[model samples]
Target: MSRIPTRHLGRYLLQGQLPRKGCLASSNYTPRGSCRVAASCSCSRCLQPFSPQATRAVHVSTSSAASPADTPIIPLRKKLKDEAKQLKKESRKNKAQKGSAQTVDGWELTVGIEIHAQLNTSRKLFSPAATSFNDEPNSHVALFDLSIPGSQPLFQPQTLIPALRAALALNCDIQPVSRFDRKHYFWWDQPSGYQITQYYEPLARNGSITLLARDGIAPEDGDSVTVGIQQIQLEQDTAKTLAQPGDARWLDFNRVGVPLIEIITRPEIHHPRTAAVLVRKIQLLLNAVDACVSGMETGGLRADVNVSVRRTGDTATGRLGTRTEVKNLSTIKAVEDAIIAERDRQIAQIEAGGSVVGETRGWTLGSKQTRRLRGKEGEVDYRYMPDPDLGPLLISEDLVRHIKESVAHLPDRELDELVDRYGVSAKDAVSLMALDNGARIEYFYNVVGGLGKRLREAEGRTPQQPLDLELDPDLKKYAPLAANWILHEFGRLVTDRSSPQDDETAFEITPEGQCARVPVASLSELLFHLHQKKITGKVAKELLLALYHGNVGEAGGVTAAIDAHDLWFHELSEEEYGALVESALEGEDRVLKEFGGNKKTYPQGKLMYLVGKMLRLGPTERIDPVNAEKAMRSRIEELCGTSA
Candidate 1:
C-alpha cells in the first residue's frame, strides 16, 4: 500500500478537501484483534495503532503551499501610504468636479435638531433647591447638585407636569412606563460623573409638527412639511461652565440638577431656514402651553443640530451621509446660521473629495462659521445603565388624561384662530405669534376682547350675545387694525425701548401682563377710537407711543393721553374746511401755473402739495388726512374751473 506524505496530507486538509481514499488507510482493510486501531490502517508510518488519545493529539497544520515564502507582504507603513495616495487621488478628482454646476446642484441637505428646554418648574428635578434663570451662581445649589458622597437624589413630582404638558402639546405618545438611566461622562460641569436621563425609555415618542405655509416657515406659501419627533426625554441639566480669562474656568452648580426635557427630531428638515422656523414653532408651542421658559435668547431653550449632505439621487445605502452635530445653539438665528454653515461645510468637503467627519461643532457668531468642538460620542461611550437609585418612572393613565385635558391651545390652533376668526392676514398672524415668545399674541387677544366688550356695551347688548367680529362691520375693522398696531407699530416701540442707544438698558414691563408697557386696555381703547373715526391714524400712533412711555397720565386711559396731548381729531365744518382750502390756494401762483389748469392731467403731487399746505395752515394739527385731502381736491377743481 502507498502512504501519503505528511506535507501532502496537511495541504489537502488546509484546502478543505479530504485526502484520497487510500492516502491515509485503505477502506477495505481490517484491523487485527491486538492492534487496537479505531479502523483499518495501511501505512508505512503507522507504527502504532490509532487510539482516542492519539486522535486528540492530531493537530491541524498549514503547509508552505498555502502561503508561499515568495509571496509579497506589505508593511503597515507602506499600506497606510498607499491608502493616503488613494485618498489624495479621490480628493483631486472631487476638486476637479467641484466647480461643475451639476455637482453643486445635486447635493441635498438633511438636518435633525435636538432641543433641550429648561422646565418651568420651581424646584430642581431631584432636589429641593429653587430653579431660577439669573439667580446668584452658587446660591441655588443643593447638596445633591454638588454631588456630595452621602447625598441621594429625591425626585420632584411637580417637574413632570410641564414635561407632560410639552409632550401633549407636541402631540407625542406618552410612554406609560418610562425610566431613567445613568449616562456616564466626565466633565468639569458634571460633578456627579453621570447624568440622570431617560435613555433606555423616554417619556414620549412619535410626535409630529406640521409646518404650514401660513406659519411662514414653509418653503412656499401653499407648501407644508411635517417634521417628525423622534422622542422627548426628561433629564437633568448640567451646570454652566463659565470661561474666564486665561485657563480659569468656573462652574455654576445652580443650573446643575435643574429639570430639562430633551426633544429630538427626526432628520426630516432640509432647508436651513426651515430648521430655524421649526425651532421657532417649537418655542411658540412651548410658550403657549406654558411648558418651559421657551426663549432661546434667555438660555431657557438650547438646540443641537445634526446636519448631513448627500447627492440627490444617491441610494447606495438608503441612508444619509456622515453627520456633524452643532451643539449648544442658543438663538433661532444661530440655529439657522449653524445649519447653513455646517451644511455648506459638508457639501464643500464632499465635493473636494474629503469625507465629512462625524463630530461635534460649534457656531462662532462673529465669524458666522462652524468650528470643530469634539468628536461625536456613541451610545456605548455614554455607558448608559438603568438608574438603580431611581426606579421605573411609571405614569398613570389618569395623569396623562388630565394633562391632555389641561394642555392649552397649541400654536397652530392659535394661528388658525388668528387667521379665521380674527380677520388677520396669514403673514400678520405668524408675526404676531412669534413676537415676545407668543406674548404679543396674548396681548392681541386681550385687545380684541376689550374691543368686543366695548362694542357690546355700545350696542346695549349683553356679554352672552354672540357678537361675531366678522359680521359686525365696526368690530371687524378692529382685528386687522389691532394686529397691525401690535405687530408693526407696537413692535417698533418695544425695539426702540430695548435699544434706546448704543449702550442699551433692559426695559421693564408692568406686572399686569406682557403688554404692560403699553397697557392692553389703553391700546384697545386707542384702536377702538381709530376704528370709530373719533381719532385719526396719526393721532392714534402718537397716543400709542405716549402710552408705552407712561406719558399717558392716571385714570382716563387712551382718552386721557389724547386730551393731554391735544391729539383728538377735530371735524371741520364745511364752511371752515372751505375757508382753509381757499387760504392755501390764495397766493400760490406757481402751484396754479404748474398743476391747476390741466384737469385731464391732474398731478397727484400738486394735490398732495395743496393738502400739505392746508394741514400746516391748521393750528391744532388734528385734521384727518383723508378729510383734508378731499376738501383740498374739491377747492382745487373750483379754482381751475374744471374737475381737477
Candidate 2:
C-alpha cells in the first residue's frame, strides 16, 4: 500500500503505509485507491472518510449463471448519456430564463478572472515616499519597501476607498470584515520577502459583468453571454525590474506598494476571443467608473490566462483537465497566441496517449510558445495568516449602499439599453460606445436635444434662427440625425488622439488627469460645428485636423470656411455635372428628340449625376436633388417645345 499526506481543507492527514516514525520516505508516495471497490470500502486507511452524506447510486453489473469470469465489463456510456441529457435540458432552460452562452470546443466556457489592476494612488502600501511610475530607481523607495531594519508599517486609507468604489461598481458583495496577509515569495523587485494580500477575507465577492457581443443581437434573439464574477479584492503591487543588455537585473521601487484590485471571475470563459473581448469590456467598465486609467498596454491592467483543454464530455459532471497558468500576457493578440499554443500542446500530448501535467508557464512572444515556469506539486504553503500590522477592516452595509449609488453607469450597459429601449441599431450604438470617446456620444445627445428646444422657441418668434442652437428642443427630437452626423461627418473632423502624429493636423494628446488621454472638448467642438452647419463636413475635417495639430484660428468664421470651400468645389461640380448633362443632350439627340418625337424613357442617370454633383459641393447645404432635377427637366421640356 502507498501513503500520501494531503491537506483536506485546513487539516493534514497521514494515511496508509508508514516507515519509521521519523522517516518521511513512506508518506511521499502517490495516493493509491481503485475507483470500483473504494466506493463501498470502509478501511479509512486508504479512503479519507466523509461525513454521513446522502448516498448516490454506485452502478454495478451482475453477470448471469454462465461463466462469470467471461462476463464483459459494461461501458459507462449510459452514465455519460444521462448527464449530457441533463446538461442539454438545463442549458435550454437557462437559455429561456437568462440567455444562451457562447461555447467553444463543444463546452461552455466559464471564465473566472482575477484582474490585478494597479491603482493610481500617491504612496506605497506601507511607505511614505511618493509613488509614481517613471521616478528614478530606488528614489521613491521608502525604508519599508526596501525592507530595511527599524522601518515600521503604516496603512493608507486613500487607496482603500477607490478600491471600494471599484468593488461596488462591479456589483460585488462587499464583505463586512476584511484583512491582509503576506504572500511568501522572493523576487529582485520584491525586496520584501513576501507580498501583502488578502487570503481568507477578501474585500468583496460574488460580482457579475455582462458584455455585449457584436452584431445585430436583439433581446429576443436570446443569444447573449453573461460572465459571472467571483470577487474583486484589494492588494499591493510589487516593484518594477529592468534588465540591461549586459548587466544584472535592476530593480525600481517606484511602483512598489501601489494599491491594486484583483477582479476574479467565475470560469465562464471558453473561447479565447470571447475572453479577450471580456477583458476589453472590463477595461471600459473600469474607465467608465473612473476606477482605473486607460492603460492596458502599460501594465495598468494585466492578464494571467489560465488555460486547460479537457475531453468534450468531462465538464458536465465536474471533471476537469490539468490546467496551465500562462503568465505575463499583455496584448489580446498574445492571448490568442497563448490559447492556440496551449491547446495544441494539450491536444498533441493527449493524442500521444500521455496525461497532461498541471503547472505554471510563461509565453514567448517571439516563438509563440509556452514554456514551463514552476509547478505547484505539493500545494504551496504561503503560510497565509492575517497581517499583524494591519487590523481588521469593517465595511458597513451603509458604506456599500452609498458606493453602489455613486458608481457611474457603464458605457456598454448604456449602449445595450439604447439599442433595446431607444431602437438604436446595434452597429451604431456599438460605434458610439466601444471607442474611448464616449463623451462624443453625450455631446451628440446634448446638441440634438438642444436643437429641439430651439425649434420650439422658433415657433413663436418672427424671423427666428434655424433649428440648430445650444438650447434647441428640436435637436432632441432629431436624435437619429444627430447620431448620423456625429458618426459620419463629425467623427471625421476630430483627430483620434490615439494616433495623433499620423495626421499632421491632429492635436498632441496627453493623458488627462491620469485618466483618458483624448480630449472630450475637441469632440464637443466638432459636434457643435456640425450641428450649426457653419463649416461643410469636408472643411470641418480639415479644420479639426489643423486644430488637432495645434492650429486654433488661422481662418475666419466657420461659415467663411464653408463658403470658401464651396467655391473650391464649385467649378469642379459645374464642369463635371454640366458636361454630363450637355453631352447627354447633344450626343444623344434622340433624348432631345424624345420629347419632340413622342418617345419615353428620359435619361434619368444623366440627370441624377448633375444633382449629386451639386450636393457634393457642401455637406451643410442640404440642397434637395429631387427639386433640382425637377427644375432641370422643366427647362428641357420648354427648350424642346421651342425648337420643335
The model with the greatest TM-score is 1
Q: Rate the local accuracy (lDDT) of all candidates.
A: 0.78, 0.61
Candidate 2: stretches off by over 4 Å: 1-111, 214-222, 364-368, 376-381, 416-536, 550-557, 563-644
TM-score quality measure for candidate 2 = 0.64
Model 1 per-residue lDDT tens digits across residues 16-82: 3454455324243434432324433333334444567643332111231344445455555776799
Model 1 regions lying over 4 Å from their true place: 1-104, 218-222, 315-317, 455-474, 497-516, 555-561, 572-623, 627-644
What total of clashing residue pairs does each candidate reach? Answer: 0, 37
lDDT of 1 at 634: 76
Task: Write down the lDDT that model 2 would get.
Answer: 0.61
Question: How far off is model 2, as Cα RMSD?
Answer: 22.8
Q: Which candidate is the best by lDDT?
A: 1
Per-model TM-score versus the true fold: 0.73, 0.64
